[model samples]
Target chain A: MTRSPFTNPYVLILPGFLLSAFIILWPLFQLGNISLSEVNRFGQIRGFAGFENYLAVFNDPDFYGALWRTLIWTFGIVIGSIGTALPIAIVLHEDFYGRGLARVIIMLPWAVSLTMTAIVWRWALSGESGMLNSALMGLGLIDTNIQWLAQSSTAFPMQILIGILVTVPFTVTIFLGGLSSIPDDLYEAARLEGANPFQLFARITLPLIRPFLNIAIVLNTIYVFNSFPIIWATTQGGPANSTDILVTYLYKLGFRFGKLGEASALSIMMFALLLFFTLIYVVLAMRGEKE
Target chain B: MKRTWLLSVAGAALLSLNATAQADTLRVTVAEYSSKTGPYFEEAATAFEAANPETDVQIEVVPWDVLLQKLTTDISGGANADLSIIGTRWLIDFVDQGIAAPFDSYMSDEFNDRFFPTFLSPSVMDDKTYGLPIAASARAMYYNKDLFEQAGISQVPNTWEDLAAAAEKIAALGDDVYGYGMQGKEIETDVYFYYAFWAYGGNLIDADGTSGLDSEAGYQAAKLYKSMIDGGLTQPGVTSNTREDVQNLFKRGKVGMMITAPFLSSQIATEAPELSYGVAAIPEGPSGARGTYGVTDSMIMFENSEVKETAWKFLDMLFEAEWRSKFTGGEGFLPVNKAVAAEPAFADNADLKAFAAVLPDARFAPVIPGWEEIAAATSDALQTIYLGDGEVEATLDGAAEKIDRILGN
Candidate 1:
């Protein structure tokens, strides 16, 4: 049947398209405009200052260090979360006793607020009174207290560890959903062909869940890239800017330093990088559709 | 025809909503000025409401970091409080933005004459009073009596040499205790150290607001802090110790001395009431200036407020001797007005008296436009020295370059 133009799915999607344009695209455009000019705390706009703000950001070592830390933050969290979550999901998918309780336990981190979790984790990770150090000390594993969040060398990994803890629950939930959707018949047929557990998982389980993994990867990347609370609560990107990520740097630039133009520029750059990674993920996923 | 009727109805509804939303109320936002669950806003609202029966005064209190975020969002969105108690260092940047109202016209001779002019000076930009100083705090030395007594110290250290000697003596107490605590975490800790450096004859910035932290005097102050840590008189964690960490140790009676504000005495009273302690002027640098960090909360009016007159009335009431003493007492802050300082409430306490005595010689942190930036860089450089990883002179030079870069020199 030939659908009327107004009744077509694409045509019906127009309102959503316009709403996204208004809510999302419009502010992005405004941010871009502000990045090229000067707007002080008073909201008064100035003529274009060319690339002075961006230049200033690039010239500062702290900003550069934060940018490097941001890259480490994004990949460390993304890879770490996905890397560990898939195996846990696989194990949990197998029929076993107390699987329901295990699933509930795995998902608990996702139910808590990020800020609340960050605060609790911060206390648990403190150098002096933290639960982790105290336990280690009681175990007689180390003689001295380790300033985990206070040292630059340890602060980044400490942040990543917290990121992974938070990210694991959400990623596991996603993986569980993906695992349930896989057709049981594929596994049965592979078994009929005398396929072992490893072969079944590698050939059948992996390919069928590729789309879900892509979604998980993309969402986790975006979430971790912009994650602020963990770093803010743990060290506030300190022990001397060692744990600073792009979002925190953007915050410091706009608020702490009152350099809104430069901060907006950094925001634009972050957006561009996110967009690039997302596009690559989407393209790869779409190519997989042909396979 | 039907769409037009719907649009007309929506417009009418919005106009009615807007009228009620724009009430004659003064809204104020404060950043983490109150303790958790403290009656900061409610008390101020009650007092402010009582003073002005016709006007409604509301206050919104938030965590300092969140408060800064909210303020930044509001200012960038062209929405802000009519009057807010903002940090003194933040006043200049907001002044440059042109949204801040200068209190020159609002300042009464009596009010202006009360505060240490230098304390209020940070709130001044281009010779205009953009804000009225409300609550002020300064960083001074706090020594633990038990630790001092244990070290066989008969008297609290009054000079740099004496302080160091005391630290060495107390370091003998072993793992659970340390002789002294100096902030080295970064940012504010560095600010604390700079005050010490300047007290010793070192200066972070020259008179023209240029970097001079690499000078010989600056090196001496930096080396002293580094040496104290190296000599085992400070906790190994001092390199990462923030105010809270230091406070924790002091509360546990683990540290002999700490450099902090009058607030430390209150902490001691609340956490370890049995602990004996005393407050003193920060030991003078070789220059003989008693350097310590000075913090002030000032009120600024938004330029676009329709009720600025009413806002000024509330602001004046906020600074009144009686009202200010009550407000500051609740928050553990010092009154900006000299009249309030003379009240028996603050005068009754010996520790409060010592804290107040230094106000005459105390100075605010560098009041440059890029003070926060310089504060972070200098603090980071100081941390490098505190960690015993770098030369004092070279670290200061690096900090100077970073500060100059920030200032666009």
Candidate 2:
């Protein structure tokens, strides 16, 4: 038997690996270079600044506020969506009337453009003329309107809720795929052994879908951490920069304020933070599987 | 052999592109102000092309919000158009970077005389003209006439005290109706605050080149707005409503008064024609000092452009009285051209006259390198004050320190 050269793993993977490396590493390198240099407003690098940009980012009080909010934004949306989507996926997995329609409806929001959805939500959440206020008033929920986006106390929470709302569609799809891959025979055998519904979920469904669940969490954390439109389209991180997450803050720093050097530094730091979190999660999940 | 064929094909494409470049194509990046803006420029380009048979005018319309970002990327890539419409406030940065070329050599005395100096001078730096004012506007107070009549206030408020009184009366009328529409979010939030800041005799920059926000004028102006917000004179949730949100309330007759740009008048014209509203001067403070915010968008020639002469001719055609008047009227801009200002459509317009009346007191955003950062700092402080999260004096003082740092004072 003659072995083909292309059958070797290194030979098979080399081109694909290089293509992905160029696609990803080139911008990462540019960002790192810009972060270490004195970049003008037009992104033209002037001279080496030797970590000055990162130092400025560290010194800014607004950057600290944004960093803190970014954590809350990422966790609040990721946890909330995963929690909501799990039950939803389990329910849809069961045979029910209009099941196909339910699946389509569940996935519908993912089809709409995020920015368009956010803009519509902005109008609906208005203080005076908003449909939300009118609906709440009609239901006798409150005597007066709630200015939802007026203060960070209210606005940030509302923004988190919006993030979770938009994030559920994608998370649920992942869960559904995981649920379908779990053999029905395993659940039937668990029931034959007189396992309860909760036991079935815990032993059969939970263990089987653990990998997908972890993947959903890691991806959602990254997406929600960097989500811009929900907060930007609504409040623009205003009312005193109170609701700014890192991405929105980075945008204002780079584009609005034209502090490209600091923005690049902040971007690199955010990328590192996301990378660290994902790496820890993946390694822990892999170790758990190994054990 | 294949590589040679590919190289020849690439060379032929490049040669063809160069030949087309010599065909006198003048590219202009226009900022879209309204739905009408693109068509207006396209029409002007068509006319310019007809007049100069050798020249082909290309219009690339960009939205106002992303114009600067687009220009920055385009410039960094060396792919910018020959001309672009930019905020006059941004001209200082462009000039400092040598991105924009001075048009002084292109401007004859008569050509220079065509523009109102108040409109044109904002784009001038270091004794050179860097931009031509393509659109100009100033802010004025718009009041609901029916609300004033219902409140039994027949006269326009010329001072803050009178405005407060009128607002109080108007607020007493109903629960849903708000007396004053104050914008505390998004673009121009600081400028909205500056209406009172300047009224209280504040200068954006003091003689020592420090920010004037920590002075008595700043405290008083902030106090006035805080009091209005606290007393329920403004709409509930002052920090939530953007300029457009407040303007929407005004159009619906829910807001008694709003201070906004001349564009709002045109917005009201089409959106709420039946709503009887009157434009008036922004009310003054106790010292009787008053000012209105003047904003201009300028058409500038890029320093990198190879077709400056053709771009200048297209600009000359754009600034001609007929086109200028048409553009001004269609977009509800205050005319930048002297002849366009004399046209009956603008001269006979009462709302524009009120905006024109404040020409002497019009304060363009000061030309500084970090003006955007300074504006952001001011806006954040104002928002804090409006939300009652921080004391007015302390917030303004903190903002002043921040701005001074940006100014390198």
Candidate 3:
């Protein structure tokens, strides 16, 4: 098994390494470089502004508002989506009538794009002709049409609900995989020990699936936070920019307004924020392993 | 030894000759709408190459969003095609970024004088021609003749009051039928609403593109829109609907009338054959103004392009009356060239004729670099007004502030 020190095993992966560097690392480096410079209308780098771009963005009210909105958007989508998904996963895990069809139907949203799903839901929730409003009125539940996506107060909730709808399928699939891996004998023992369904979920299911939940939450958080198409297609974060997430605001700065420097700074800040969340998840998981 | 040296020189010369042959070819990226006009891009390219045997032209068709992204990215990276189709609204931004090349020197005075001034004006900044209009669309009230007949109405309304009455009569048909269709979403659709609003006595900002959102006219416009929604004349999904959905509803015979761009004529004739529609000027407002917003796409050359002459030649060919009439007319694009409207294809088409007739009343969107941001803010304010949760004045005022932020005012 003796090998020459010069015959490096890593050298064999040179092509793959080169490809990764070209595609991933190079873009990251370029993104970093652009964050430090001013890109003009023609996409040429004009001058170096040091961290003035970052400083300007940090002080801008829109950026601050987007930061807040992004937090709320992430928090609402992550917590709400996972909260809805885990229960559905646990329920689908149990044998029931039409369970196969139900699983397929539940996963249907995943088959479609998040943008398409948002569009359909946007239509369904429209003030005048939306199915929800029609049904509500038909049931004598309300006499007036409710502007679900039009008001600042209702728009955020509507966005979060749509995010949850689009995200639930992925979360449920991940959790279902985790649930199936758990031995039935463990649940049976818990049941025999006088644990109820709720107790079984709390004691056995929750503990065993915590790791999966962490993965699901972190992934969903990133996807939901960075999502642009749904927000753009539906609201463009409107009704006074009340629904603007960081990504949409970033998009406005870069594309709509042509503020490349500010947009790049916003992007870097977003990366930092997401990285922070990822580190927290990793730490929690490591702590869970220790426990 | 002398013979060997002579053969080596001959091989190097042959290699240099091959490169010169390849240099004749030009690659371009254009929107799919532009491709639909002729034999796709390939056909037009073939024609261009045939006309100029020395030069070869190639075109790549891209979706609108992809085209915008590609154009921006390419320009930013100091690389771009010689020419491409871009929305007129984006012209200002592109010019500001210095990606667009001014074509004044390449354009003949006669050709420049032939265009509808507004369509040309957006492409002209600081007295320089940055682009040429490839296709243009003007918004107008498209009313369904059959729906009017069903509702016992004979004439399309010429004033706002008459229009309102017609909408009321048509809305009486059933819950599935709407008297009018308007763009109610948060993006470009809102701009359509603004056209009517401005006609009704609203102005976003002054003519100089300042903050006019909070003005009396703007308030009246917001309130008028709210009244339409509140009065039950608008469709069920009006507030959250996109332009496509509104068009679809009209084509499905669900809407009795709508304000839409001229391009919808193809769909009205093909998909909604049962519904006979007529185009009319946007009804006169309280201000006694009859107007519609004009949208156009222009052929812009990038500053970094190495093939400026080739690009200009291609654009000139695109705007040629006969070629454009055949190309844009076949693809259902409204020709931007004023002379092209007189061509047999557009002139003979009844729907296009009605649309073309409204050209005298058409106006362009305000050509400002921050127009998009202001448009978005105004749309949001309008949405809030629709909800009845925000005051028209306050919403407009807030929107004005946001507009100022975008305009750096």
Best by TM-score: 2
lDDT of each: 0.80, 0.92, 0.78
Runs in model 2 deviating more than 4 A are A1-8, B1-22
Per-residue lDDT tens digits for candidate 1, residues A1-291, read 877889988789999999999999999998888888977654456788778878877877678888888888899999999999999999999999999999999989889999889889778877778898899999999878887776778778877988999999999889989999998998999899999999998998888888889999999999999999988877777765667888987877787777788888888989998999899989988987987
lDDT of 1: 0.80
* Candidate 3: stretches off by over 4 Å: A1-25, A50-52, A55-65, A84-111, A119-159, A176-203, B1-21, B34-39, B50-56, B109-118, B147-155, B172-174, B200-209
The residue-level lDDT of candidate 3 at B336 comes to: 67
Residue B95 in candidate 3, Cα distance off native in Å = 2.9
RMSD of each: 2.9, 1.8, 4.4
Write candidate 3's Cα lDDT for B1-409 as tens digits: 9999999999999988866765566768778763364255677788888888878787767877556667767777656777888888888887886778898888888788667676777688898988788778877788888899999999888877787889999999987788888667755756766666667766656776578777776777677667778888878645566787788888877787788877788777767777777887778887687677777888888787777888778777777776777767666767667798667777787777777777777777777776766777777677777767688888788888878877777
Error of 1 at A227 (Å): 1.5
Q: Candidate 1 DockQ category?
A: acceptable
What overall lDDT, based on C-alpha atoms, would model 3 receive against the true structure? 0.78
- When sorted by lDDT, best at the front, the candidate numbers are 2, 1, 3
Q: DockQ for each of the predicted structures, in order?
A: 0.49, 0.85, 0.43
DockQ of 2: 0.85
